[model samples]
Target chain A: MIIVKIGGNILDNPERLQAFLLDFAQMPGPKVLVHGGGKIASALGQKLGITPKMVEGRRITDAETLDLVTMVYGGLVNKNVVAKLQALGCNAIGLTGADANIIPAQKRPVREIDYGFAGDVAGPESINADALEFMLEAGLTPVFAPLTHDTKGSMLNTNADTIASVLATALAHKYKVQLVYSFEKKGVLQDAADDASVIPYITAGKYKLLKETGVVNAGMVPKLDNAFAALQQGVAQVLICEGEALPSINTRQYSGTTLSLN
Target chain B: MIIVKIGGNILDNPERLQAFLLDFAQMPGPKVLVHGGGKIASALGQKLGITPKMVEGRRITDAETLDLVTMVYGGLVNKNVVAKLQALGCNAIGLTGADANIIPAQKRPVREIDYGFAGDVAGPESINADALEFMLEAGLTPVFAPLTHDTKGSMLNTNADTIASVLATALAHKYKVQLVYSFEKKGVLQDAADDASVIPYITAGKYKLLKETGVVNAGMVPKLDNAFAALQQGVAQVLICEGEALPSINTRQYSGTTLSLN
Candidate 1:
């Protein structure tokens, strides 16, 4: 089984999405797709007078920002992706985290700096794999939007990469699946400024060194943390790679950094 | 503070929603509004191959059923209400329960008799009362569709009346809010078959008796439950009445019955 995380960047191009869907429609096994939508959401926010702000790379979701994002993420972006997938003749089911309690969450407590409406994931209950299997069994690809559950039963914003990693970890342990974080970047850069010098592989030892050296800055920090968390939990392998240009999956010497237990 | 739960029955008529807004706008008090979309949602569902199933009186919301409902609730119905509300100069914010963790919830475990994608209220987090207050403070009406949060971090389907009642319970202690359940019925009938004969009033004690004897049957059961729950939870009063045919907030002799703690 394979789980692919589609970056928000890729969403900008209709051509690329169609390309991705064409490739995806023919891919083997039950594939679960996850997506992000920061770019478009931000644009909508600009129009709505809700200036988008970020805390640690996540949208600082206030009431106004919340409405804007939901409209973008749940409405415009979700439907667009679903339409593309459907056009490619793939039996794809598009859903937000709230559908069927897909992701139970607890409201994040007001911290020193109050972040309004941020949701925390419930660690105790996991995604109902049976329904997922049922969809897969019926030849349907599940395209998930990132929104999660917190104990307060509120819909909270979730990073798609993190959601992908968690789902990968869950599905990997259950069915031995490979999880790929597909983004615009060819791979996780050893230095953020230099995209060419990609880290060929990430290991626990190497990951720690990078973190300790503060090389894993900003957005990459959370993405990697979630990657490592997935590894720690049960995922077999997770890859962070360029989604837009990749012509093949797991092609040796193709591109993208591979993060694994090894 | 009155928590008026309006039915979307009249929402079909733009003039009706506008009239309600005008009537509500003139009312001089702190109040909150909740509403539903039985007609629009069901019609949309039928077109989408999702039959709106009513086991007893509640709509059965399965996966397909829910997808259709979401499209209607979050997209058409929500925006429809918002548009009309906005035109009426109400600073109306249309929301799906998923946004800002508005209404926290617990996913009803799938039973042998499934409620489908339905959810019940959980968590003590009230509406972003301040945000609503800001709007209400500025003379904007907050119109909520019947979606609720499934504490599992996703939006869940909720009956509109229950949503209205829940909001009333949550906000009633702070204001002189009335939990209003507006429906097709003229009022709570002393005799179920006699639509014309609206029960003038019911004491909390009498409500319990009527409820137990099946006078409060089917849809009435949940509505009564929410009504009773609201009273028990400290809501000032509960009004079960005709949402579509009501004369105005100015006149008290509207079609629906009024129930109170007595």
Candidate 2:
């Protein structure tokens, strides 16, 4: 099973998203698409007079922000993707973790910096695998928004990357799960400034050296960490590629980084 | 099987909706919920500087309005309902017609009045019965937003009452269906001024006479029409009640006007 995740950058571009979804629909297999909230939420928030609050560059999902994400992520972005996919002959059902109690979570507790209504999933065990398996087995692709429920009557903002990884890890028990993180960039670059300097493959040993040498830093660090964690947790493979590279990835003509434990 | 619909008034009031949902969750058996867009969409549209265009007392669902409703109804209202239902121990899955391709519709054809983005269901046959039955049999209650999709790749605004009716009519082939329209009022009233004037039961014969006498006018006319239409289309029973009366209705105490063909 292919469990692909696309970030906000792709979602912010309509043409890019449509092109990506068309490729996703044509991919021959049972798949799940998890999407991130793009600039739409912040844009809508601005119109509503709700300025986003951030701490150390991380978004603080306050009550208003939670509502904003729920509408933009869960509603506008998710439904639009489902509709487009359906048109492409892929049966896609949009979902948030709260739906069918698919992913139960707890509100991020107060620490040095309170994240407000943010949620953290426990692990693969916390996911409702049966619900997902049912959809996939029924020939339906589940498209998820970046939202989970606290099981206490509140919706919580969740990281789309973590959602994708946990889903892959959880479903690995039943299917050969390939987790792909598709973003704006082609792949993890050896030189961040050069788009053509793509690192095609990275073993755990290589990843460690790259991290130690400060070759991969910033957002890519946490993303690769999540990818490696999924590998350790039973996922068959993990890929990081551009949204446009999905067709090539599906055809085995890999154009991006494939992570593995060596 | 029970198919219940709630309008925007109850949705606009949090406490009232919570109480109503608690009652709904406590009710036994397989059920589905269809919800309408309350003032929230228009309110949000106002914030976004998109003024609503209405003709002949009907809101014109232009592109902006469609986006607005998708965000509010599909996103804000629908997901909130699902999360709250989960908190109440009900396994609720939120959906639009676009999700799982359950409800496919055509964009309203332009004639005298072009109701932009509005969709009309092609009767009971157009509904995806198997998909809904699978969810219901799996013990998941579906909560639908007032939206449908054209198979050609666009989400369209639909009426909540129509959605509820079509679902009831379609599912009647598999299960004995009870269609309910729950709003702020107690039931279809004989006297619009008095809450106690709820007509306990209305057969087709009575409905015709009431219409002739102009006893039930305005919105209730179309509601009763839909109710009767649902009854004609294979639904076993229909009820119009207050949102809080679900438990009572479930228990057969009947605190609303039950409709029948007679």
Which predicted model would earn the best TM-score? 2
Model 2 native-contact share: 0.91
Q: Specify the poorest-scoring 10-residue window by lDDT in model 1 chain B.
A: B83-92
DockQ, candidate no. 1 = 0.03
Q: What is the TM-score of chain B alone in each candidate?
A: 0.84, 0.97
List the candidates' TM-scores in order: 0.54, 0.98
- In model 2, which regions exceed 4 Å deviation? A250-252, B250-252
**Candidate DockQ scores, in order:** 0.03, 0.92
Q: Candidate 2's C-alpha lDDT?
A: 0.93
Please report the candidate that would top lDDT against the real structure: 2
Residues A118-147 of candidate 2 have per-residue lDDT tens digits of 999999999999999999999999999999
